[model samples]
Target: MAHLLHIDSSPRGDRSHSRRLTREFVEAWQQTHPADTVTYRDVGRQPVPHVDEPWIVAAYAPPEQRTPELWEAIRVSDQLIDELIAADILVIGLPMYNFSVPSTFKAYLDQIVRVGRTFAIDPEDAEDPYKPLLLGKKMFVITARGSSGFGPGERYGHMNHQDPYLRVAFGFIGITDITFVHVENDEHSSESLAASIAAAQAQVAQLVAA
Candidate 1:
């Protein structure tokens, strides 16, 4: 059975669309694969610490050479990385804030995406210096936005950075098999919001079954 890492990064509680969708997805996933294990993290509620000077030093320094203070600095990072590496499937719930991800989610990303842990740097290789170590992983992102038309060839496509940025960042760690389920038009009419929620629920059901 696969181990799933479920993360929600929406500050809102009951009002968060992405949070609800991800919860439904995980519940359906469990029903489909009852033997699968899941680990949950709420980065929005309990934000991970952002990278600092000591964190930078600790991350770059070899594990064997790191001092106790350096090790202490990277303790959280190590735990986050270990959690990430243990998962075969990742489900992330993200709500677009100010046209991008929430700062809390970004902070969690900064904590987990570490060199020599999630990725490796090979300066000796002239052609390819940075190498991704996390491979054979699948990711599903459920995103919520206030507005609509953020898809490809849409009016807001040019202004959309949420999905593309996620792709690039997750791909950097060798997770290229990524799928996104977006619930938009949240700021629109009640009918539109209901329709969006229904559509997202249907999509989640289909994805989980598949």
Candidate 2:
């Protein structure tokens, strides 16, 4: 049975479209794969610590040479990485903020994407020095946005930084097989919001079944 890591980064409660969609996706997944297990992390409510000088020093230090204080500084990072390494699938609820990801979610990404853990650097190969350590995993991102037309070649595509940023960041660690489902038009009329939600729900259902 596959293990799933469910992460929600929306600060909103029941009103959050991303949060609601992610929960629905997980519930649908459970129904289909009864033996699968899930681990949940709510970084929006309980934010992960941003990287400091100590964290940076500890992250790059040699394991044997690291002192207790150094280890303590990276304790949360270690835990977050462990959780990511243990999961076979990841489902994240991402809400767009200023055309990008929320600060809390960015902090979470910084914590897990580490050297000698999620990725490796090879000095011998100048052409390709970076090697991804995490493999054979699938990821689904449910994004909520205030407006629409963020898809490739769309009207607001050039202004859309959220999807591209997520692709690059997750792809850096070998999560190349990523799918995104978006719920847009949050600031629009009720009819527009309802239509977006309906489309997103349908997409979620299809994805879960697949």
- The lDDT values for all models are 0.93, 0.96
Number of colliding residue pairs in model 1: 0
Clashing pairs in 2: none
**Per-residue C-alpha lDDT of model 2 across residues 59-130, encoded as one tens digit per residue:** 999899899999999999999999999999999999999999999999999999999999999999999999
Best by TM-score: 2
lDDT, model 2, position 99: 91
Q: In model 1, where is the ten-residue run with the lowest total lDDT?
A: 150-159
Against the true structure, what is each candidate's TM-score? 0.98, 0.99
- Candidate 1 per-residue C-alpha lDDT over 67-107 given as tens digits, one digit per residue, 9 for 90 to 100: 99999999999999999999999999999888889999999
